[model samples]
Target chain A: MQSDLKRIVSKLHSGMRIAVPVDYAGVSMALTRPMIEAGLRDLDLVCVPTGGLQVDMLVGAGCVRSVETSAVSLGEAGGAPRFNAAVKEGSIKVIDATCPAVHAGLIAAQKGSPFLPLRGLIGTDVLANRPDWKVIDNPLSDQKDPVVLIPAIHPDVAIFHAPMADRHGNVWIGRRRELAPMAYAARETYVTVDRIVEGNLLADEMTGAGVLPALYVSAVAEAPKGAWPYGLWGEYPADVDELKRYAAAARTQEGFDAYMSETAQQGEPA
Target chain B: MSNVLPREILITTIARLLEGVRHVAVGASSPMPAAGAMLRRALDENERTVRLSILGSVEHNFFTNGSCELFDSAGQGRIDAFFLGGGQIDGQANVNLVGVGDYPQVKVRWPGSFGSAYLYFVVPKVILFREEHTPRVMVEKVDFVSAPGVSDPEVYRPGGPVALLTGKGLFSFDKTRPGFTLESTHEGESLASIREATGFAFEHADSVPETPAPDAATLELLRTRVLDELEETYPAFAADWRRDLAALSVPA
Candidate 1:
C-alpha cells in the first residue's frame, strides 16, 4: 500500500496526463479548481472516457489533452454525455477506450495470448480498421497469431472515487465496479475514498478485485464528494442542472472567474 | 394527434427513419441516446430494433456486475443512438474538445473530447443532438477539428452522421453541398434568434420550416411505457431528477 495522498500535492508536475473516470467529477473538480484559479503550471491534462459528466470542466479549466474513444462516438458530441468543442478541437484524440473490456482485450492482444477475449464492444466499430487499431502477430506466442492490438494507455496518473481505501493505498470500488481496466491501463493510480479502513482487505471482498494495489498507486487522498460536479452513488453529487448553469455562465472568461470565486468557498454541502 | 406536442413526435420521426436498421450499437457514457433507443422499444417497434450500450463513468449510473464487465443493459447489446456533446462545432460539424497540441505540452489545454472522434465514424444514422445553441458553440471553421464531419465523410472509414438536432430545431448537410445547411427551426424561435446564437454563418437556401409540436398520445405513451420503466430501473436517480424537475416547474 502507498502513503498518504498529501504527498501528491508536493509531487504535482507540469506535464502529467491524469486519466480518470469522469463520473468522479468531484475529486477532480476539488483538485483542479485551485489550479485553474491560481493559473498554476501544474495539473496539466485530463483525459476522460467518453460520456463523462464534467467534460466541460476539464475543457473550461483548459488542462486537457486528447481523449481516447471508439470511432462510433464521433457524430453525436453535443447531447447527454456530450464532448464539448474545447476538448474536441484536437485536445480530443481517439483510441479504443470505449470500455475497460476493450482495454483488456487490447492488453491481451499486446501480450499475444489468444483471442482478445472481451465482452463489450463485441459488435461496435471499435473493431474497425481505423488508424487507432493494429492487428499484430503474437510476439509472446510460438504460433503466428494475429490479434487486434490496441496501444497501451500508459496514463501518467489515474485517479478514481471509491467507497473505501486503506492507508496503504488499497483502493476499493464498492458497488460501482466499472473502469478497473482503465485504472490498470494507467501507469500510476490515485484513489479518493469515502472511508479509510485500517487494515488491508482481500481482493475478492471488494469490487473489481481492488484493481489499484499499493504497489501501483502513488498516493491515496481522503476526499468526499470528490465526485462532485459529477456524482457518487448514494451520497451527494454535483447538481447536473447546476453544472448546466455553470456551463451557461462559463462561456466567457470574466464570467468564469466570477463563478469560480463564488463557488470555491462553497464546497459540496456536508 | 392533440395540440400538445410530445417528445414522441420527434423521437418517432427519427424512429421511422430507423426502419431499414438491422444491427444497432451504442457506446458508453450515452444515457439519453440509449434512452432514445429504448423509447423506440416503448413505441413497440420490436421487430426492427436497435441495441443500446454505454461507457461507464465515475459520476454516472453504476450498479455494475463486475469491473470492466459491461452493465446488463450493454451486455445485452442494448445500446444505440449515441448522446454526445461538444462546443465550437464547425461547418462540416467536425467536433473538438481536446486542446490543440502534441501529446505532452498543449498550449491551451481543455477537457479531452472522449468518444466523438471514434464514435462519429461508426454509429449508423447518428443524430448530432445538442440542447444548447450559442455563437461560440456553433461555429464557422472549428479551430480544432478532432472528429472530421461532412468535409471528410467519404474519407472516414465508418458510417457517419445522418441528422443534427438542437433545441432550436434541426440541421442537415446537402448531399451535394459543402457543409451544414439549415433545415428547420423550432416553433416560436426565429431565424434571427438562431443566427444571433450561432458562431458561424447561418446558411439557408430557403425559409426554414417550423418544428412539429409533440402530441398527447406520444407523451402519454412515454409516461406509461418509457418513464415508468426508467423509474423502476433507477429509483434513486429518478426520484432526484423528478424532484429537480418539479422545482424547475415551480413558478419563479
Candidate 2:
C-alpha cells in the first residue's frame, strides 16, 4: 500500500483511464511521466492545449486518446484542436471539460440550492448539452420552475498538482484557481506537491487555497519538479530533453520496460 | 501608484478611438474603457440605444444576479471591440502559441491565449494590445501562428486585426505588411524606439504622427465614470485595480 510511485503505477492492469486537467507547457511532465513508467500508458488524458503548456507531453506520453475542445485555437493548425501526428488512435472518445461542472451545477439547479458542490463529474463535458450547456430547467415558468437535470462526469480519477498542502489534506493553490470544482468531483483524487507546508506557516490569506480535506486525496507525493518537467510558477520549463527522452521510450510495453531497465541500471528504484 | 485616475492623455486617446461608434465591447480586467463608455453614454455617445456590451464582465454588478459563473471570456463577444495579446507575432501577422523552439519547444512558454483562441475569429474589430513591445514579443515569424490575419478567405475566417495598441505607438497592419504596418507613435516615442522594441524589423509609413493627448471632456468623463463610479461600485475589483497599479503588469 505504501509503495513508491513506480510500484503503485507499474502494477495497474489495463481498461483504466486517468484525467489530467493541467495548464499548458510541459510542466506536468514529471507528475505525469511516473504514471507511464509505473505502467499506465494507455490513459485517456483530457488536455488544455494552448492552455499555455503541455500539448507535446500528453501526445508523447501516448496517453491522450482524444482532445476536448469547444472551439479551436487560432494557431498554425488554424487552432484546430487535435492529437499529435504520432498519436493516430481512432478509438478514443472526446468529451467536453466543463461537462462535469455543468452536471454538478444542474444538480444544484434542480435542488433549488445555492451550489450542490457534489463529488460527481465537474470537469469533462458529459453534462454540457443543449443551449443550457449543462443545466436543464423548465423555461416554462418565470416565477417558479420545477427542476433541472445535469449529467454526471464519470472519469475514474483526477490528478491535482498544487503549490502547497497540509498533512490534513487542506490544499492551497497560493492564488485563485479554476479547477477546484472538477478536482472535488472526481471519484478519487491524487495530489502532488513541491512541499507540504505546516498549518502555522500558512497565513490566513493563504489557507483554503487548495481543495482537499485530507480524506479526498488518495495519493500525495512530494514531486518537487513534478509539474515539470513542465513549468512550475517560479521555476523553469520542464527539461524538454528528458521529456523527449521519455516519449521515445514509453510508446510500447517493451519501450517502457527498456526505459525502466535503463533507469534502474542507473540506481533508480525499480 | 494606486489605480490613479486615468491620465487625461490616455483617456482622450481611447475616447477618440471609440468615437463615432454606436456599439462597443470591453473584456475582463479592462475597466478604464468601460468607465469611459459610461461617461460617453452620459454624454450621449449612443443617444438612445445602449452601445457597449461589456462581456467577460468581471465587474461584480453583472455577475452576482445570475450566480454569474460563465466559463471563459470568448463567448461574450456581442460588443464591438475585443482585445488580444501576442507572445510571438511574426512578419506574416501570425501569432504563435505552438512550441517555443524550432522543432519542438521554445525557451519562453506563454500561458496560451485563454479565449484569444476564438475571439480572434469571431469578434469584428479586434484590437491587439500589449505592454511589452520587444523583439521576442513582436517578432518576424511566431514559432506557432496561434491565430493569423484571415487571408485564406475561401476556407478559414479569422476576424482579422483592426489596430494594435502598444506603450510606444499605434499600428494598423496592411494586408501585405508582415505583422502590422506602423501607423503612429506616442508623443515621446520615436521610430527608432519602436524599431528597437520590435523583434522582427518592421516597415513604417514615411510620416508617423504623434497621438493627441485626451481631450478635457474625455478626461473628466473617464475620471467620473471609470475611476469614480465604476471602481467605487465594484468593491471586489478594488483589489485588482490596486494590484494593476502596483505591478503595472496590465493596463489599469
Deviation in Å, model 1, residue A147 alpha carbon: 15
Local lDDT at A198 for model 1: 76
**What is the per-residue lDDT of model 1 for residues A92-194, given as tens digits with 9 covering 90 to 100?**
4434344443445434433544335322121232344245456565577676544444445455676666666776677766554444554555566667776
Residue A52 local lDDT, model 2: 16
Q: Estimate candidate 1's alpha-carbon lDDT, on a 0 to 1 scale.
A: 0.51
Instruction: Give model 2's DockQ, 2 decimals.
Output: 0.05
How closely does chain A match the true chain A in each prediction, as TM-score? Answer: 0.68, 0.58
Candidate 1 Cα misplacement greater than 4 A, ranges: A1-5, A13-17, A25-43, A50-156, A174-187, A198-200, A203-211, A240-269, B6-8, B20-35, B45-80, B83-112, B130-144, B150-156, B165-219, B227-252
Error of 1 at B31 (Å): 8.6
Off by over 4 Å in 2: A1-270, B1-12, B19-77, B97-99, B156-158, B176-179, B201-203, B229-252
Candidate 2 interface RMSD, angstroms, 1 decimal: 13.4
**Candidate 2's residue-wise lDDT over A230-268, tens digit each?**
445444433445545645655454665566467644432
Q: What is the C-alpha lDDT of each candidate?
A: 0.51, 0.49
